[model samples]
Target: MSDNRTWRARLIATSAPAAVIWIRVYVGVVFLTEGILKFTRPDTLGAGRFDKAGIPAPGFFAPVDGVFEIVCGALILAGLVTRLAVVPMIVDMVGALLITKLPIVWGDAPLFARESGFGDFLHEARLDFAQLCGSVFLLLVGAGSWSVDARLTATARSAASH
Candidate 1:
C-alpha cells in the first residue's frame, strides 16, 4: 500500500552528515553494553534494580527492557532504520529518567541508588542524559552518508528514477 511505502521512505531517507556516525557509535555501544549488563549484573541493573526502583512487574519488564536495548542498539550501530530504532530508545531513556532519576531530584533516591542533592542526581544521571540527547539527535537527523539506511535510500532513489 501507499501508506507502507510512505513509511518505508521516511524511515530510510537521510541527509545527515557523515560525522553522525560518531554519535551513533557512542550511543550504540553504551546501550549494547548496558543491555548485556542487565543480565550479567542483575543485582545492580536487572530485575533486582528494577524492584528496588519500585517498577511494577520487575521480573517481566527487566528482561524485556534489556532485549529492546540489545536489539535497538545493534540496529542503530548498523545504521539500519536509525530513526525508528532511536524512537524506542528515547522512550526508554525518558522512562528511566522518570522512574529512576526523578526520585533523586525529589531528594529520595530509589532503594538501589543513593542521592542527597541535585549534584548527586547530576552525577548519577549524566549517562542517561547523554544517551537521551544522542537518541533524540539521531531521530531528528537520520542516519548519515556512511550508514546502511543511506545506502538503501540511494538505491531506492536510483531505482525510482529509472
Candidate 2:
C-alpha cells in the first residue's frame, strides 16, 4: 500500500509539468488565433465593435490593442518567454470584460444570440470567464516542459558552468 501511494505520488509529480505544458499550448493556440483574426482585419474589430460596445476612444485604443494581441499571441505560441508574453493578454482580457461587458451592456439582455434570453447572457459570461481563467493560468504557469524558453534557459545555465 505504501509503495502504491509512493508510485501514485511520483506519477502526479511527473505529470504536473506535462499538464502545465498542455494547458499552455492550448491557451497559446487560442490566443494566437484570436490575435491573427484581430490583426488581419483591424477594421473589423476596430472602432466599430468598440463603438457598438460603447467603449470610449476606440480609434486611439484599437490599434494598440491589436498589436499587443498579435505580438503576445505569437510569442506565446512560440513558447518564448511565455509568462511575460501572456501578461499583456491577461491585462487585455480584463480590460475587455470591464469595458465591454459592464452592467448596462450585460443588461443588454442578449449576451450571446441576439434574441436569446438572460440565461444565454449568463452562459456567455461563463464562457468568457473561462477564457479569462485560461489566460491567467498561462500568465502564471508559463510554457512548461515543451517550451523553447526552457531549453534555452537550460542551455545557458550549462554553458555558464563550463
Candidate 3:
C-alpha cells in the first residue's frame, strides 16, 4: 500500500505540468482570435468600438492594441517567452475590464443599453475576468515542462554543468 501510494504521488506530480499546456493553448487561441477579429472586423472591435467606448485616440490605439494581442498571443502559443508574453495580455485584460466592464457594474449605462444591473454586468464581464486570471496564472507558472522555455533552461543547465 505504501509503495502504491508513493507511485501514485509521483505520477500526479509528474502529470501536473501537462495541465499548463491546455491553459496556455486555450488562452493563446482566445487572444489570437480577438486580435484577428479586430483586424478583420474593424468596425466592430477596432476603431469603431473604441470610438463608441470613448477611448481617446481610438484610431491610433485600436490597431496598436490589436498588434500587441497578436504578437503576445503568438509568443504564448509557441510557448516561447510565455511569461513575458502574458504581461501585455494581463495589462490588456485589466484595461478592458476597467474601461469597459466596471462602468456597467457601477450603475453607469452600458454602451448598448440604457442601464444594466450588477448581475448583468457580472455576466458580461465574466470572460474578461477569466482571461485576466488565466493570464496571471501563466505569468506566474510560466510555460511549464513541455515548453520552449523548459528546453532552453535545460540546455543552459547542461552547458553550465559541462
Candidate 4:
C-alpha cells in the first residue's frame, strides 16, 4: 500500500508541470487573440473604447497599448522568455485597472451611460483583474516543463555537454 501511494504521488508530481504548461499555453492564446483584435481594429478598440472608457492619454496611449498587448501576447504564446514577456502585460493590466477600473468604481456618472452606475466598471475591473491574475500566475510558475523554453534549455544543455 505504501509503495502504491508513493508511486501515485510521484506520478502526480511529474504531471503537475505539464498541467501548468497547458494552462499557461491556453491563457497565452487568450491574450494573443485579444491582442490581435486590438491590433487589427485600433480605431474601434483603440480610440473608441479607450475614449469611452476614459483611459488617460487616450490618443497616444491607445495605439501604444495595442502594440504592447500584441507583442507581449505573442511572446507569451511562443513561450519565449514567457515570464519576461508577461511583465509588460502585468504593467498593462495594472494600467487598465488604474485608468479604467478606478474611474468606473469611484468616478461620477458613466461616461458612455448605456446603463448608469458602477456595474460596467465593476465588470471591466473583474475582467482586468482576472487577466492580471492569469499573467501573474504564469510569471511566478513559469512556462512549465512542456514549454519551448524548457525544451530549448534542455537541448542547449545537452549540446554543451557534448
lDDT of 3 by residue, 10-83 (tens): 22221127578888888899898898888898888998888888899988988999999888888888777887
Clashes of each: 0, 0, 0, 0
State the lDDT of candidate 1 residue by residue for 1-162, as single tens digits: 233367888887889999999999999999988899899998898999999888999989999999989999999999999999999999999999878887887788766254656787788888999999999999999989889999998998777778
Point to the candidate with the largest TM-score: 1
The candidate, 1 or 4, that scores higher on TM-score is 1
Candidate 4 colliding pairs:
none
Predictions ranked by lDDT, top down?
1, 3, 4, 2
Give per-residue CA lDDT, model 2, range 1-162, as digits (tens): 233344322211221264576666666676667666665665666656665666678776777777777777777667677767777787877776666554434455222226344565455556456657877776556566667666665565466568
Which regions in candidate 3 have their CA more than 4 angstroms from the true location?
1-16
Off by over 4 Å in 2: 1-16, 39-44, 104-106, 109-118
TM-score of each: 0.93, 0.73, 0.86, 0.74
Q: Which runs of model 4 end up more than 4 angstroms from their true locations?
A: 1-16, 107-122
- Cα error, residue 129 of model 4, in Å, equals 1.4
Candidate 4: RMSD to truth: 8.1
Model with the higher lDDT, candidate 2 or 4: 4
